[model samples]
Target: MLIQPVADLLSRNADHYLIPADIVANVQTDNNLYHAFLVLTKIKYSKIPVLDHAGHFEGLISLPLITEQMLGFDQLNVEVLMEKRVSDVMETQVKTVPNVDDVESTLHLMIDNPFVPVVDNDGLFQGIVTRREYMKSFNFLTHEIGKQYDMIEKDFSTSEKSK
Candidate 1:
């Protein structure tokens, strides 16, 4: 129940919650908007990471970003979808964290993102830490802390009665 111990608990164990890079769906920088859209649709994710040929993290692509570019005069422009690259419409200012970062940092980033992309020192895409996963872990920790606090209170009451 102590603030510092709880804070330390929250700061540890981010690595255990990661969804590894092999399972994360991503689009390449050179992929056309149409292809990126298809990937997002199939994955059912609003956004995903964009990687370069060498698998370095570049940016993030979302269905909305792709659709906005495809809209023209009240109709969808197929040409723009086919010709414009994902890089042209992707959000390059996305928040990213190194894999070594603690869950606290990851949690902070998740306030504005559904998932925080993890990268290596060289910016190679490592994986993602989703808000859903982090919240689940946090919920479990809260329950554990509550149980411990209850036991401590019981012990204190017994000692007081003995005194």
Candidate 2:
């Protein structure tokens, strides 16, 4: 109920929120843009993680990033999509939360990203913590806390009236 307590409660381990790397759809750095685009389209996700053959977190590739390569001055350059590697177009500056992170930091990162990738100290891909999953946990905590406070308030009022 208090600010400190709420903040502490929200500081849950990032691992608890993880959508493990194994289940997450991703593309390797060597993958061509054409294949990456198809994967994104098939999953209906705007973007997805990029990894190395060793499973290290490389960056992220989006539909727009692939589409940009397809655009040309006069006509669509379909060849670029087939030629360029995902590493050539993937956004390497993506923000990633460490595996040791807490939900509090991940929550901040999720403000701009749909999901924040988690990586180990070795930069190995761990998983992602999605905003949707965080929201579900937040919703449950708020409602349960609200109900507890309401019961306390009701008890307080009853005692006041009797006095």
| Number of the predicted model whose lDDT against the real structure is largest | 2
Candidate 1 residue pairs that clash = none
List where candidate 1 sits over 4 angstroms from the true fold. 11-13, 149-163
| Candidate 1 lDDT over residue span 1-163, tens digit each | 3366566555565567789988999999999998998999998999999999999999999988988887898787878889999989899998788873565677678888888999988999989988888787688777776764543544578788898
Candidate 2 matches the true fold with a TM-score of 0.84
lDDT of each: 0.83, 0.84
Models 1 onward score TM values of: 0.84, 0.84
Worst 10 residues of 2 by lDDT: 146-155
Once superposed on the true structure, which residue ranges of model 2 sit more than 4 Å away at CA? 11-16, 147-163
Question: Where does candidate 2 clash, by residue pair?
Answer: none
Model 1 sits at a Cα RMSD from the real structure of 5.8
RMSD of each: 5.8, 5.8
